[model samples]
Target: MANGLDFFSIGGADAHDGARAVHAWHVIRWLLCGWSLLVIPAFYGELTSTSQGALTIARSLYLCMFAGFALCLLWMLHTSRKPKAWLAHNRLDVTIMIGAAFSAGWGAPPWQTVEWVLRLLFVGLVAIRIVLSLKVFFAPNRLIGLLIAGAGVLAMAGAGFLWLEPRVHNYADGLWLAFESSATVGYGDIAPTTPASRVFAVFVVLLGYGMLSLVFASIAAAFIGKEERALRHEMHRDIKHLNAEIVQLRAELHALRESLTPSSDAITDAEALHSVPRDHH
Candidate 1:
């Protein structure tokens, strides 16, 4: 029963509530976006750092981002009339935030099996949030923008592979591997050998499939939309033509009636002649 405006708006009905909700929504969305972007560098630092100081700084940055994200969620919940409903509506967000916090808090040997698993989970959650945010904020007409964003994400993932995968010597090789994995091409020229790289490949494949599907869908939509527009134009033209012909026919019918029938003036003169007394006798 929700109208488009209401659906898009965070506040349900009240204008004042809606205005506050809108602001909160924007803040939260932007914060989430910033946090998602920062994750790459923060995670890279954690993974690549040799010094304890560098690792601590990276972890601190990540923790700060998580705190900001949590605070945003709290603000959003506070803005809503029904906190429980809001929580229900955004269970995934809440769950991911909780899981991420837990993962970040659980300290393990850096780059070890457990650490890698946690990292994977955190990265996957961030990716999911990015996709979800895109879906919520962007319209289908923004497919081109989404495509560009996808390319950026792909590039970042490639870079991630360059660092995470030992076999990937250069950015180009990592990018090639990412493309191959995402497209499910698996060219066999380069492959992920390590457990971490393989896990990363899995994420790449999933992301690739989603992005490729979106690309195909957008293309198909474009073609279908073009056809629809053409059909609509043809229909409008035909209707207009028919209407003009109808008007012409009406005008012609009126002219034909005038020619076939006696005019008022002529009928009056004919009545006058018939009224002549001598003529009648």
Candidate 2:
């Protein structure tokens, strides 16, 4: 994960409209987030019901959209003057694209399995990119919520697999097994007998731990940061109040000193009267 501060280092262009143009571009890129979220779910829902021709078309559309996003990121990376900054910003994106390409090209097992993996890659990559790109827009709590949602998605997948497997008794059993396995609780009430189920368990465990850690860390950071900010603000206010009070006290002290001091005008008049008396004597 990139440090939060690194995000701010991406400074603006020199032109007057450069920042605006970049903002517009980012907004347009952000639209990919909506598109990916909507279309990926629709693709999954239609997977079983749609004809092969329709499925192919939907997949093709997905590929095109994914390609567009990748291309835009590539352009950004290429145009950036600072190579390190570009790499720091885009490394994750590049990783996702590379992983997807590798999966599509070299993934083994049945074609259906390959396709499903691709679908997952598409959803996961897009979801992550959306979160990262719009990090400023989302609160840490919301980001943690997204992490939980991702975990839920993973759990659901595991449950589906467990239920579909012949060894698994029922849906409830599958759900329990998935939850336990993912949580690393290892109740051992339900165990994966086959190699395939065991393999699935491994995936669930890894993803589960990852999501849990991310959620916990995010929540802690958010609350701690909020408290620190509040404390800092209160301290600043208190300091300002103290300073004002000190200023007011100084002003009052000056006023009091002035009143206590004999008036210059009165002293001058008294001296003049004395001088006149001496003349009469």
Candidate 3:
């Protein structure tokens, strides 16, 4: 009688399906881009009435930023899913969002609908980026560092609010509020008074601290790790050099001893000549 062995196979065909999820996001992003293009003409009303050319530029930048970032985010998700991938996206995303938020706020007039839209977009992008990127900093020490950075952003934002008395008039004010919310502190003394402002505030509150924390922590950790690695490499190089020097010194010492000592043949010949003198006697 012969026995038979059974083999089993498991798992779905899309082994790295999460990676593919980013591509779907890319398709969604293009659709949004088409919509943004269509919407540009509509912004004429806000641009013409407010006379905020800077605001127009800022708004256009953010729209493009979002689309560009959405594609990059998809690619990032495809290749990696760690601090490296997440931070890479967050770095550009946060910088753009923060800059746009301030530029639009300061450059554009409030009565313009475009200004409000720009603000909302900036807030949304930053909040979303932060929320999504938080997973990269999981360690306790990193978490603490991130928390501090969040707090700093929030503090700056709060100070701006207090300075403006809750009025977000310009980039300075936008920056202040963005940082404050990211810090996780809302005094409510100078809170967002308008509906749009309030909504954006909520969005910032939700994503601010968490996202900033991870970004700060991941950046710090990377720098510290790089520094440590460099130091270790230098130390290793120095140690190797020292070892070679020690070997050379050892060889030199052996040569020195050979120079100091007479050859056995010379000693023996001397003894033979001296003994031959005695034999001659």
Return model 1's CA RMSD, one decimal: 5.7
**TM-score of predicted structure 1:** 0.71
Two-way TM-score contest, 2 vs 3, winner: 2
Candidate 2 weakest ten by summed lDDT:
8-17
Instruction: After superposing candidate 1 on the true structure, give the runs of residues whose Cα lies further than 4 Å from its correct spot.
Output: 1-17, 37-55, 107-123, 136-147, 245-281
Per-residue lDDT for 1-281 in model 3, tens only? Answer: 31231101111112344655445544544443343332223232233334556456546655554555556545555654453534443353435434443543354445467766765564454444333333344453475656665666566555434433447666666766676665656655345775445554665576574566566767787788889999999999999999999999999999999999999999999989888644353
In order, candidate lDDTs are 0.73, 0.59, 0.53
True-vs-predicted CA distance for residue 237, candidate 1, Å:
0.8
**Tens-place lDDT digits, model 1, residues 1-281:** 54544322223223344677666776677676676666666666666677888777777777777787789788887886767766655655665567556645556445677767677777776776776666753455557876886788689888978988888999999889988999999779999886557767887899888777777777788889999999999999999999999999999999999899998999999999999878454
* Candidate 2 accuracy as TM-score: 0.53
Ranking of all candidate structures by their lDDT, best first: 1, 2, 3
TM-score of each: 0.71, 0.53, 0.33
Best candidate, TM-score: 1
Task: Please report how far candidate 1 places residue 120 from its true position, in Å.
Answer: 4.8
- Write candidate 2's Cα lDDT for 1-281 as tens digits: 65765533333222343454455446545654554454443344234323656555555555555575577565554554554655565455555555534433342333376666675655565556665555564454666565757657566855655544556777767877777877799977778775346545765677677566666777888789899999999999999999999999999999999999999999999899888744454
Assess candidate 1 and give its lDDT.
Answer: 0.73
